[model samples]
Target: MRSLIKIYRATADRVTGRNLDKAAARKQLRILEEIEFVCIGAVAFGLFLEMPSLCSAASLVAFGVLGEFVIHRFHVRASKREQNLSDKESNEQLAAIAEVNLKAETERLKRVEIEERRAPRRLSMEQFNIIESRLRAFAPVEIGVIPTAKGDAEPLEFAADLCVLFRKIGWLPAFATRIDHTIRLGLWVELSPNADRLAQRAAPELVVALRIAGIAVDQDVSRPAGGEFGGTGEEKERACGAGIILNVGLHPVTARGY
Candidate 1:
């Protein structure tokens, strides 16, 4: 049994080596064929369509045939060389396989190795939200805050992260985010690519929420001409400039608004 196991391992290694050699040979041949096909196709198409003079056409055809001959000759030599190499490698694998006994054990170990590999991505949205909340809380916030909302089309995980981030900082109140974009009372905020238009584009529901929170939109916050967001610093000042600002230091937590 022991001897058989040793032989099996040896065979497996040889087989893997031969397979790699075969793949390399096939790749080289494909590259050569592709180059030949493109060059030949282009020359043939041009000769048939554009060359009007018979002497020019004849010379082109003759030169093309000569090129083809050289290419084919090279291919034949390369093919023969690869075939010999492949056969030799395959024989080695076969010899090892014949001398081996524990193919099942080897196969089992290979499967185990693959199974141990880590998955592509780690954190779920809910989990990421928690982390973002923590990070945001630590992030500095001034009178003005960047109110970011992932579009409705964004992935659930991404949305959760954004919300979590918003909650952590002074940007949003605790659990301030909701899955629904509209209020049950028939109020909703408008979704737009441009945040500057929020005052105009935001639905009645969103404006009401901001108003309720004491975040009155400053009409006097003149829009900057050269840039967008209307000088966010000024906007923050406006928010702070209000008679009173709420949730200035409070953590974002969820609460229902009618």
Candidate 2:
């Protein structure tokens, strides 16, 4: 199919170069007609002279000329047919390509629409109750809800909601701190470099609490964010003895769990 198109294009280009588009191979047809006429006159003259040799020769030439005319006529028709076939098939191929491209673009637009409707990962009221009850065992622990910066607001919104919950639980700071840091993705647990055994012991329980409520926390326990913030707190009774940071990050395309 491809080769046929190529041949057709090349032939068309040559025809165009010689200005054959309008001429319709008329010149060649005229030349063949003239030759046939001359052959017919020769045969007639030979027969009038009563010469068998001349008559036979002229008769053979006339037949050959007739054959040439027929061959040329059919060749033109055949070429026309080939050109028409090429044109039709080429149009069909282009139409198919255009349709495929349009389908792909339509799919892309659908994905964009879905993304627009997609809501951020949320924590429900029942999950909140479960988490609050679980945290009661790790009360007095300090938590800094830090949400990472991203192009989309989904992470920020989710982080803000989670921050409100932690604040209401009385373990987090006033609000979530917005920081420009390139760190690990998804829900991560960050521990202070100076975090004592109390924070270490509470880390597993915290993971369980979040997971039990169906909140996906990705990592086990990562060290502090390169000492970006001090884990130490005010030394007093009921103060945060076990300090941990919940680094709220962008949601992953695929959800993972323990």
Index of the highest-lDDT prediction: 2
After superposing candidate 2, which stretches have Cα over 4 Å from the reference?
1-117, 174-183, 221-258
After superposition, the stretches of candidate 1 with alpha carbons farther than 4 Å from their true spots are 1-21, 101-258
How do all models score by TM-score? 0.28, 0.39
lDDT of each: 0.41, 0.53
RMSD of 1: 23.8
Model 1 weakest 10-residue run by lDDT: 238-247
Residues 167-208 of candidate 1: C-alpha lDDT, one tens digit per residue: 454344322333433212111122222223322322232334
Report each candidate's C-alpha RMSD, comma-separated, in the order given.
23.8, 12.8
